[model samples]
Target chain A: AQSVAQPEDQVNVAEGNPLTVKCTYSVSGNPYLFWYVQYPNRGLQFLLKYITGDNLVKGSYGFEAEFNKSQTSFHLKKPSALVSDSALYFCAVKEGGNNRKLIWGLGTSLAVNP
Target chain B: EPEVTQTPSHQVTQMGQEVILRCVPISNHLYFYWYRQILGQKVEFLVSFYNNEISEKSEIFDDQFSVERPDGSNFTLKIRSTKLEDSAMYFCASSGRTSGNTIYFGEGSWLTVV
Candidate 1:
C-alpha cells in the first residue's frame, strides 16, 4: 500500500545548528510529497511540497527539502535551527492522479534548544 | 492570503451525542476535505467533497459520519452518534481546481468525547 514514513520519533538540535527530519515514501505512481508543521494546539501548517521540479524545494519559515527519487526520500532540512522551530513535523504523500487523499507519516517532534 | 477556517475550536460532548463541525473553505477552492488526528497519532483522511457531493471517503468514514456543503459558504461534518474513540482533532481543508494543487488546512476543531 502507498505509505509515508518518518523514521525519527524526535530530533534535537541546538540553536543555529543544521537540522534534518527524515522521510521516505512508497507510492505506485509519481509522488506528490509535502511537509507540514504543527505547533502545540495548532493545526497542520503547510511547509513545502515537491511535485515536479528541481530536487530542492524551499518552503515557509526557512525550511527546505530535497526530493531524492532514487532513495525514495524527501527529507526536510534547515540551515539554522531556532527554538521557535521546535514542533511536530509530518510528511505526507499523494500519488499523481485523480486521488485527492494524502497518505501521512507518523509525525517527528523536533526540539531546538537555545 | 486566504485560508480555510473552522468553528468550535474545541468541543466536549458525552458519548452518543450528536456533533457537527463547521468549516468555511477558501472562497475560490473547488475541493474540500475532512481529516482527523488522534492525539499523538498520524492524520487520517475522513472524506472529500466536491461539486456538492462526496467524491471520496475512507473506511473510517462510516455510516455515523456525513458531510454536506449546506450552502455556498459552509461545509459541515456531522457525527450521528459520537463515541469515546471519536475524540480527535478534526481538520477541514481545501484545494484549487486541480488535484495537484496544495491543500490548505484550517486551525482544526478539537472534539473531546467522554
Candidate 2:
C-alpha cells in the first residue's frame, strides 16, 4: 500500500524568500517520490523525482526537493521564490516493485507574493 | 520536447450518457495511465495500459470504466454511463519504462456530468 500527505492546503511566501512545501509518504517498500506543479488551467508538469541515491534532487525552474528517509518526508524547496512560482503543487508516490499506479497527495496551493 | 496531449479539453454530458476521453501520449513512450481529480480532491489513479492491454487498475476503475489504445496514436478511456459524481478532470500520462521513470501528463479533459 502507498499514500502521500500534504498537510498544508496553502502556503504563502514572499518573493525572493526561501519557500518549502511539505510532503510525507507511507509505502510498504521503497518509494519513488515525485513533485509536480500545476498552473491555472494547465496540466501537471513534472518537477523532480527521487528514485534513489542522492537525497537532494534538483528540478525545473530552480526548484528542488530533499528526500529525508528518517522522517519519511520529501519536501519541495526553492532558495528564492518568484511570484510566477505560485501554483498548485502535488506530491506523488509509487511503491517500488510492480505498482505502476501513482498515489497522489491532496495538493498544496503555493502563493508567492511580491 | 514531446508531450502528452488530450482531447475535448472540456465536455459536458447528461447523466447516463457514455463519454470517451482521448489522449495521444508522447510518441516514444510505452506506458500510459489515466487519472482523475475531482474538485477539491486528490488525483486518483484509474488505470495503466501497455501493449494494448491493461497492466493495472485501481478500485476506482470499475466495470463501468474501460481503457483502450484503439489505434497506433490514440489512447482512450470510456465511461459506460456517467453520473453526476463522475464529473472530474481526467489526466492522461505516459512513461517510458518503469514507475520510477518520469511520467508526463496531459493538460486534462474536464468532464462535467449534468
Candidate 3:
C-alpha cells in the first residue's frame, strides 16, 4: 500500500516571505505525487503534480515542487507568501505501478501573517 | 473551467438512516472517485469508479457503501445505514483516466450523522 506523510500540523510565515510545506511518501515502483489546497467549507483544489519528468514541476497560484526520488519527497514551495494563501495544504500519492489507488496525508494548515 | 460538482453542501441525518450523496463529474472525465475527510483527519479514499463499474475501493468502502453512475453524468454514493462516525465531508473527484493524470474535486458535501 502507498502512503503520504505531512510532518507539520501548521506552519506560519510572514507575508512576502517565501514558504515551504513539506511532504514525503512511500510507495512501490514509481510514485505519482500531488499537492492540493483547501479553504474552509470547500473541497481541495489541485496545485501541482510530479509524474515522470524533470525533478522540478511548476503549478498554479505561483507554486512549485521538486520531486526528490532519493529523499522520497515532493515539497510544495512558493516564492512569496500572501495573506490570501492561508489555508490547508495536502499531499497525496498514487501508485505508479499497476495499482490505481491514491493515498493522502493529513493536511498542514498554513498561516500567513501580515 | 470544468470541475466536479457535489450537491447538498450539508446533509444532517439520524443514525441508521440511509443517505445518498450525489455528484456530477467533469463532462470529459472518465474516472470518478469518492473520498471523505473527518474533522482534523486525512482525506481517505472511499472508492473509484470507471466505465460504469468500480475499478477500485479501499477498506472503508465495504458492504455498507455502494457507488453507481445511474446516468451519463450523475454519480452517487449510497450509505446503507449511517453512523455517528460517518459524519464528515464527502468529496467527489474526477480525472481523465490517463497515466499520471490530475484529478479535479468538488466543493464537498458535509454529512453529519446525528
Candidate 4:
C-alpha cells in the first residue's frame, strides 16, 4: 500500500523569499517520491524525483526537494520564490518492488506575492 | 522535448454516453497510466498498463472504465457510461524504466458530462 499527504491546501510566500511545500507519505517498502506542478488548465509537469542515493534532489525551474527518511517526508523547496512560481503542487509516491500504482497527494496551491 | 500528448483537450458528453480519451506517450516509454482529477480534488490513479496488460488499478477504475492499447501509437481510456460525477480532467502518463521510474504526464483531456 502507498499514499501521500499534503497537509496544506494552500501556502503563501513573498516573492524573492524562500518557500516550502510539505509532503508526507506512507508506503510498505522503499518509496519513489516525486513532485509535480500544475498551472491553470494545464497538465502536470514533472518537477523532481527521489529514487535513491542523494537525499537532496534538484529539479526544473530551480525547484528542489529533500528526502527525509525518518520523517517519511519529501518537502519541495526553492531558495528564492517568484510570482510565476505560484501554482498547484502535488506529491506522489510509488512503492518499491512491483508496485506500479502512483499515489498522489491532494495538492497544495501556492501563492506568491510581490 | 518529447512529451505525452492527449487528444480532445475538452469534451462534453451527456450522461449515459460513452467517451474515449486518447493519449500518445513518449515514443520509447513502456509503462502507461491514466489518472483523473475532479475539479478541486486530488489527482486519482485510475489504471496502469505494461507489457500489453494492466499492471495496477485503483478502486475507482470500476467495470465502467476500460483501457486499451488499440494501435501501435495510441492508448485510450473508455468510459462505458459517463455520469454527472464523471466530469473531470483525465491525464495520461508514461515512463521508460521498469521500477521506481519517473512518469511524465500529458496536458490532459477534460471531460464534462452534462
For candidate 3, write residues B16-58 as lDDT tens digits.
9999999999999998999999988889999999888999898
The residue-by-residue lDDT of candidate 2 on A1-114, one tens digit each, is: 578999999999999999999999999899999999999999999999999999999999999999999999999999999999999999999888777888999999999999
Candidate closest to the true structure, highest lDDT: 1
- How does chain B score by TM in each prediction? 0.99, 0.97, 0.98, 0.97
List iRMS (one decimal) for every candidate. Answer: 0.6, 0.8, 1.3, 0.8
Chain A, candidate 1, TM-score of 0.99
Stretches of candidate 1 off by over 4 Å are: none
TM-score of each: 0.99, 0.98, 0.98, 0.97
lDDT of 3 by residue, A38-97 (tens): 987778999999988899999999999999999999999999999999999999999875
Off-target runs (Cα >4 Å) in candidate 2 are none
Evaluated against the true chain A, what TM-score does chain A of model 3 have?
A: 0.96
Could you give the candidate ranking by lDDT, starting with the highest?
Answer: 1, 2, 4, 3
Clashes found in each candidate (C-alpha, N, C closer than 3 A): 0, 0, 0, 0
TM-score of chain A of each: 0.99, 0.98, 0.96, 0.98
lDDT of 1 by residue, B1-114 (tens): 998999999999999999999999999999999999998888999999999999999999999999999899999999999999999999999999887899999999999999
Top model number, TM-score: 1
Task: Give model 1's clash tally.
Answer: 0
Worst 10 residues of 4 chain A by lDDT: A94-103
Candidate 4 wrong stretches, greater than 4 Å = none
RMSD of each: 0.6, 0.8, 0.9, 1.0
